[model samples]
Target chain A: MDNTNEKLGVGLLYNASLPEYLEHNIEQVDYIEIIPDMFWSDEGRNAYPRFVDLPQWRHQLNWMAKQVPLVAHNIGMSLGTLNYFDKGYIQFMKEMNESYRFRWHSDHLSFIKLPTKGPHDHNAGIAIPVPYDKDYLAMLREKISFITEQIELPFLIENNVYFVEYPDQDYSETDFINQLVSTNDQANILLDIHNLYANSVNHKLKARQYIDELRMDKVVEMHIAGGNEMGGMYMDSHAGPCPDEVWELLDYAVSKAPNLRGITFEFHESYFPLLRFDGLNKQIEMAKAIWNKYTLQPYYHELA
Target chain B: MNSPDFQLAFATLIASPQLCKQAIADEPSVFDQFALTEKEKTRLRSVLRQKGMSICCSLYRMNRITPLYTQLTQTATLLGDELITLAEEFWESYPDSSLQFKEEVLAFGQFLLAKLEVGTLKFPYLQEILRLELAINELSYTPAIIEKTVHFDYDIVAILLAMDRGTLQTERLQKVQVAYKVYLEEQTLKLALL
Candidate 1:
């Protein structure tokens, strides 16, 4: 099946160094989403994804897995880039999956490669977006298909934020996503509301318009988070409280994405200190209220 | 645009605002370096014209230098105006960055150490500071014991310990014989003076 049969309610992105406040509120979160890239160091450029000197991180990840259901949210897999692929990064994911037995795994829909990954592939220093076009879609199809064959769990590509405006193309951003789903059966959308909200504001588009247009059934998981505003531009900085605009979009989106299994709250570690304990719980509580509603239906599976 | 050309264009334009402007102006000579197709060049021009490319550069520069600022506070403070120039040179020398932050940082330290040895870097304390920072990184990333001998008017150990231990930075003009040992225990590097 394209989507998971199990259910995953509201969860918090787990960093080993979570605030002391969250320790008391651990039970408030249903599950934890772990970004493997954060825990393991891919030793220098040509080391080919070798884990380096992260003994403490390995211990923490092992401990966290025993506590609750842990899902792998990968930040390193640059699935959209076509020419060169990081076979080592793929291998790392496979090894991690074997150890953690993550219910599912996801990566950003952007390209982030080490210099050694390809010839003439300059490092972008950040997870920048890929172009929206038919050839681009074809590239993703082949890459994603290979990933699906290698990793058994359901894989998702989170809707990433892009600052660049490509010249007009055959597909809108929504159309590009829809085509991606049509290409691979196991592939699904990780629908990041905050990213969508940021893109809408930055590009002067409608959140509702894109949400209604997308094939919501393909959305197996969703993400919501807060970001910082620098120089009048809303960034996907993942810095602070969930913006009102994202929450507003979430209120409308929850009903539309019927197959949605998980809704994760993402915030960077630097921003953890800026957020109050009460505020974090309220965001979880808000997600719970919505999860509690849809979960009442027969369509929603039991929480894993 | 094909993936290779597009990826190359992104890397070039993001790293250099001057190239973005050149590409925007339809300067074939500038974008030819990136192997950009005519269509890719046009799209890149459109995007860079939106003025977000500068923001991208700023955001990336901030992420890159954040660790340097935190770890090399004294070095950065001492260099002041030259720090930016040093960083740009380092970036040019080693364009590829690792996701492992300490790797990127240690590489910069290595670059400085090379510069210092080659007489390209002229500073009173460059050698000592680079040695101390690189030693800390070495200790963190590996358990291999490090033994070194050096002489200086200032106490390098005291300044390093002060950064984390809050010990006061004491100034003493003395050429003292000392042995330095560094190793990791419980995620903290233990520096022993013998």
Candidate 2:
């Protein structure tokens, strides 16, 4: 395959336990997404205690940056809290960005920590859902601006899965997203295709129409994954193979978003047994075939 | 105690003290909102005043007595009924044949039944309750009837029952009991051995 003709790339979100050279397997894929938080802590069994310090991880991450663009997906920026953003966290992220020099950085657009009457709750790191309202939008804009100021890189926000019940809100999901993008002209979006599909299935909405209505020009990346069904709802389980609906939605979204930079395959080791890697490879082939079919020749050549 | 409009008056008294007092002092137009007849409203106001006074006196001493005593009593009764049902199900599912294994199984069942009476077992208590039942299920297994017999080897069955009880007591039940303040750690420890 002509490297230039491959405008799209398949890449794994780097897992620390996986040998660094595992990147070679999906090397044919265009770009790799590295989760900075995974490297932030040196506690896990397979994790390199000095992964952030190691030249190979840094050099290889940067090499991956040159060979194929690298994007930073973060897990710790609690964007939805009333409390001030963690300056230490922002500083750490700045240091990492300086070391690897990623194309962009994205985090979930939901709160993880809250103002409690006790010690800052560290265990409350799970992404929490926020109501779509004017007040919430204002809070999100301030947080996003703060992050953008610290990183100097374009900030992207990914939509999240909400498991708990929330009181009725005035705005719909599309309206909420539209307002967020419009408020921050510099903001980019990471559209998790499976998350959108899961939300549509759980909430009973037209998934394709939700994608159709989005400001696609603002979308820079897409995420696809599998979910487990729990308590009459599908938990965004990230544990299995992508459903056909999600793949079809991805194809439709690619056609819609002309500026989509890359697609990431997010796999969790805990649920690795449930996934069919062969099926995932076939999906990638399907995505590339669709990209070839729809992408205009001039843009394709320019990417080449 | 048997006032025609007692329910309406009681609801009003519980909801708003100011409204209840006004209603007692002089029937108000808001009483009309309750859709009570003139006689019924009078009867309701009289009974509400009596009940409200009694409640105030009860509350003054309620702290000295056991809080939620009525609720605890009802819960214990319901749990006891559930335990009996579970015990009956276990017996029906596994008819006793061996004297030693049967006694062991019945002893475990009795332990659970005792715990249920204490009102310490948490919701979705079936899994733990069933483990005790399964341990007793050994009596149902007979080695001589090999052609159509349930396997209940001593080590395998004992290990499984131990594992199940350990998970139930330590992992599932303890986490819920602590999280929801359903039972104290001391109380849970006492029940665990059972």
Candidate 3:
């Protein structure tokens, strides 16, 4: 899957409010990035057909798939979970790809699902950041190999937004990501600029320095969004439009990431009222400006 | 360092602030259930003391309750400020959420139904609204169009409208027993008076 020359312009992460928006403005979007898990319901491990399609959601997804190219952003993989791996979930993803024909797929570098004694697995209710240690990296590498074998799509791991950082980690976040992608050919990065901004505000770190340390070529996609202040900390709540700082970071990131295929603007559907169709268009327009600035000319000329 | 156990312990702490407080207080048996390595235990203890842990716990509760808020809008809106305490109690009883929207909504709906049946949760038209919302959730997942009926003993439309307006007054509304058929037709929720 050589996406080096592929450049998908500004896109939106699919949400419940998107059907109506996409209906009127399909041409404005280059592609749709969907969370495949949202389109189906997983009955517990005991159920014969463990994954059931929610017709209403599938109807919407089918409608959108016809309108534009789609990429899957998954939340169920939980690849960082230590000993537990749901090959069944990966198998289901393969079936979904067969049906939808996604361009590429990605999941977070964090764990959310924990196996429980009950019939269903326990959701951590949040994506928990994994410790950047050699042992965990090795664990993820094996899991990534299995996933790539099962589904031949380009796989990406999004950098996590950590509210709490573990003590005595083996590597910094950028080094960890660089090492992981260096070892796995099919694995790359989904550079979430908002998550980096959140971490910068919360931890008092330089976001640019963090970005500079990263292997820019590994970045295939980037996410930008708005968040609000909670408990005196700037949180990545995805509440509304992208902040000015996020746009700046995205501009810098886009200039560096030559292989970047998409700049996805994410906002929770509940915030649809805040970012009505017009507001959403504004975000996409801003992203396209950055995209065109870097993607229109030769990479070297743009840098010069 | 026993990554599974460490994850379990961390997840448990996030879901229950009571356990988090105990862990912070250095309660001897707070983490007796997990087989965590000493380093893991030390890390958990240190992390719990950070202010971000509070945010993590808040985020956990918000995520668990989102399905309920989205699916059971009328029931949740009617519960008003009481939803927080009720949700906390519900989480205390059932610590793990499947994270599936229908499953979480149904689980929370069943929890509310049990409370309403036992006379512990009392309110005018509460049962009717809850049953309607739960039916809608169930029907959204059901592929085939099928009708399910709910009997309401009050002027349900007036009640719902007033609730939407945030000016619900049960005493001002009239009592009228009626059965409404709730079903999904062509992927759209429709209601018919029966």
Best candidate (score: DockQ): 3
Which residue pairs clash in candidate 1? none
Q: What share of the true interface contacts does candidate 3 keep?
A: 0.72
lDDT of 3 by residue, A62-165 (tens): 99889888899999999989889998999999999988888789999999999887768889999999989989988988898888899987889999998888
Q: How well is each residue in B115-188 modelled by candidate 2, as lDDT tens digits? A: 55676654444333333234323212221221222232122233335454654224332222111111123112
Q: Which prediction has the highest lDDT against the true structure?
A: 3
Top-scoring candidate (TM-score): 3
Clashing pairs in 2: A9-A30, A10-A29, A10-A30
DockQ pick, better of 2 and 3: 3
* Displacement of the residue B189 alpha carbon in candidate 1, Å: 3.2
Q: Provide the lowest-lDDT 10-residue window in model 3 chain B.
A: B138-147
Q: Give the TM-score (vs. native) of candidate 2.
A: 0.54
Per-residue lDDT of model 2, residues A1-304, tens digit only: 2221123455557664334345444554666788876443222223233223333345456556666666789876777554446656677788887877677789886655433333232212245455566767777788888778888777788977654323345577667777887867557788998889877876676888888788877777788888777546675767657788888888888777766667787776545445445554665666566556556546643432
lDDT string for model 1 (B9-106, tens) is 68656776666676777667666676777788777767777756777877767777876876666677657789999998887666666535667678
Model 2 complex DockQ against the native: 0.02
TM-score of the second chain, each candidate in turn, equals 0.77, 0.26, 0.90
Model 3 segments beyond 4 Å from truth?
A1-5, A300-304, B152-158, B161-168, B172-178, B186-188
lDDT score of model 1? 0.74
Q: Give the poorly placed runs of model 2, Cα more than 4 Å off.
A: A1-8, A20-24, A42-67, A115-120, A274-280, A296-304, B1-194
